[model samples]
Target chain A: MMIKLETKSLREAYGLCLVELGKRNKNVVVLEADLGKSTRTVLFKEAFPDRFFEMGIAEQNMASTAAGFALAGKIPFYNSFAVFASGRAFDQIRNSICIPKLKVRICGSSCGLSDFGDGKTHQSVEDVAILRAIPNMTILSPADAVETVMMMEAMLDVDGPVYIRINRNDLPIVTPENEPYKIGKIWELRKGKDIAVFATGYMVKKALEAAEELSREGIEVRVLNVSTIKPLDTKAVISHSKGVKGIVTVEEHSVIGGLGSAIAEALRKEAHPPIEFIGIQDKFGTSAKNYEELLEAYGLTSKAIADAVRGMAGR
Target chain B: MEAEKVKELKKVALKLRSNVLEMVGVGKAGHLGGSSSLAEITAVLYFHKMRLNPKDPKDPKRDRFLLSKGHAVLIQYAALVELGYFPREELKKVKTLEGLLQGHPDMKTPGIEAVTGSLGQGLSIANGMALALRLEKNPARVYVIMGDGELSEGQLWEAAMASANFKVDNLVGIVDYNRIQATGPIKEVFDTGDIPAKWKSFGWHVIEIDGHDIPQIAKALDEAETVKGKPTVIIAHTVKGKGFSFAENSAAYHNAALTEELYKQAQEELRKQGELL
Candidate 1:
């Protein structure tokens, strides 16, 4: 029998969390680049009209302005589409925010292929890769609404600049609600000895599903949720990789510089099992009728992940 | 302004030039042209305008200044050194690995509001600070200096619109209109026509003045603080390499090593200017 799971919108959670954070901290301000409604920062605008800045389709200005706000002892969160946030305003984010080590939180909403209808122009597959190269940047990718709220809170305590990727859809509520979130600690959702699966963002749900599928086939698959991409928990990754027959790294980002590469770099110095990367194989996303169709077309489904594990497990 | 104050500020300007020469040293390329162009403006801001305490450089209520045209940072370093933000001895170690002063403005150095070597970014940061200060009901103001050639950056225009849209009256922007850039003349390279008109059309309170004139610089800054709803931009027309006769209006000196002979000549010129003041 197939068990049903509940889903929650990460954007909604983000909006509600911002309102709560605003009420608690008067210094918390929000800046948006004419995508408030889409990014859900509009909710913050309605609640704290005085603190919200309408930067008007200018991501570069918004990013640098957010740096200014940080310099003045305010915690500024600037939001834009992932492509523009990480690509168009890259120089501002690098020179103004990261280089100075400001207390600014950059929210790249609708990251990955979650914006399936918009196609390659709007989707951001290389944001992680591009941001990872910058110094003094903390990268976060939450799996579900619960994790999004947790990550948002955790971002407040971080001393330096942070980049958090948010998906466009309501994903499966996989992360536990009561558990406290740590910035760089890896979350192991399942215990197994046969195969290890490291996943992040919405792909964490897929990895859990793949684990269940592999379990029925008598393959014990371990699923690890890697929410923090930069300052990666390499110790946990190395410790978990030991004794497992093989490993499968999954993300909704480019396979080149995403979680797979991070895990590969972590285990390079240590003796570990062989690894398989399950992500977009160096391809831009195309328009699809729905999100699931794009995920399936790109071989990002549970079945494909299970197949990778099975192939690596030699079953 | 009193004659005594004017003479004092001109002397400060001359000292800033001398310090720039010291930092660049002989036979080592540095941003002598832009840095010299900003000598008078930096002298006025550091000595007359801008509330700063060297002991408490990060004072929350203190006025903020950012060099958007950060290549001209040698002048700012001179001002900071005079203000005792750091030891004057650090001037000799600029651009060195262990030096406190860098080739551009960095937060690692004292009293720098933001990292702003890359052009077109400092104005937006100033706007952000203005908005925050207004939100907090703080009376502190923000000032940013931009190069005329630096205005070619698209982000600068974006920030221009934002500052006016937000009505950042507490923020002031001064363009070091030296009319020269790294490669050549801004007019020949990439002319941004009608500079004053462009700023006025952007809804700023525009003021044009001789940047080297200390009294005019002080008056424009005073006028900016009284403007109620819009930000102000002072277009301070200046000569590139103002103090050094050999480098004046010459792009070659924009960032070039000063030979020992030329460096001595530059110092002698600044000393003469100081005597006249």
Candidate 2:
């Protein structure tokens, strides 16, 4: 039942989705902090010049300015690197955006190890840990380009603040086209009873790959994409993982506060089960030749997930 | 321009100062030093310059005022109540739990264009409103009041540069350069050397004026409107805690409340200022 889908970068989908949204609603405004080329908001700026704003190298100002636009009845989407958008402007986003519950959608690009060439400063490995503590903030980490578009559309209907972390590299489009995506909902891609492989963002692809590898060895594995990191759907996570022997959470982010921590927090009061975490382990990333090398160095590949799955299932 | 009108604006300024004393004195914990510094600036706008209506605070054509230095929200609250944006009785409950007035300015209250208190963020929001209005070809102007100490935030510099680059001529920024910070003088705590030149280098039309003077404040605002193709910033030299002699230029009064005896004494001095105006 595998569908042959084209591979495209999430940033490409993010840019095109904004262009489409700009056409759909004139109230849709895009603001970029001197990263239109990398963030791909240039597509939106080229399409709708009037609605696009070039804020220039100021992430904090860009966030608060977006809040002003939101207050003036415009849906503003501001973008920058995850490290800057979520880290440097943490206070601005908390007070100016989240405290007032302004409808400013913050898209943090080059998340985790995605910006491998630029090194640790560009790669944001702990954005979820930093943002989840803020009140009235919704966090979404899309798995692929298609889901990125769907989440962008979903945020327009939402009234409060929403942060979506986008990957840098192109990934395979795994989700079925035209599939409805909602905030705080899980998408069960492959079902099995032996062990659950919970993943998010780029790691969802890694989890699916690990599931196929485990399937060849007669160890049935279940894979779930928890896109909405905040307001974790504990019910779906627990129900789908009821009879599984163990669980291994995979993410492109840090193991402390990303998908692994979310799953652990959800299963806190549940029955006996061992949970394994796979991500950047409580440390900074390094400048690498490619993202693949960084992933392998950080133990964030499909083989790492597969090994964790087998170890958790006591194989 | 008229002497009688200047007297009236001064009267509003004195009354607003008294109201800040009453509200913050009742609230027992409010920003007195910075709030006092912004009294004349807020009065010059609400009473003389800005085009607004108490009945229709959200009128699209109305000029906007944002208090970026949100800790001094009592001054703005006094002006809003004077304009009848809300009931005068609400002033008595300032900063109380579940009160209409909070420690900082919030959009929940009418006439508050944006929620601000976190310093160095208001100018950017004001610039954003200017951008939106410019796109609509609307002639509405946006005014933001920022503290001198608030300029320590890097966001303010970024916003200043962006607003000028965008040619947001309809936006005006007024700095209450009261020469003091929350702890001490701005020079001792992250001083921004020569603010007027700093703003000028950012491509803004800069003006220096006595902040407490009514006619000068009004005339500066008018002059700002005539300058085309760029935003304008008025650097007003003001004293922290102007009216009361004991609180003047005292950092201890930055957030400290006055005692009952001192409160009555300050009220007497303020009543004299009111009568003189």
Query: lDDT values of the candidates?
Result: 0.92, 0.88
For the predicted complex of model 1, DockQ is 0.93
The digit string of per-residue lDDT tens for model 1 on A55-154 reads: 9999999999999999999999999989999999999999999999999999999999999999999999899999998999999999998888888777
- Candidate 1 segments whose C-alpha is farther than 4 A from its true place: A1-7
How well does candidate 1 score on lDDT at residue A7? 38
Candidate 1 residue pairs that clash: B29-B257
Please tell me how candidate 2 rates in CAPRI terms. medium
Interface RMSD of structure candidate 2 (Å):
0.9
True interface contacts reproduced by each model, as a fraction?
0.87, 0.63
Query: TM-score of each candidate?
Result: 0.98, 0.95
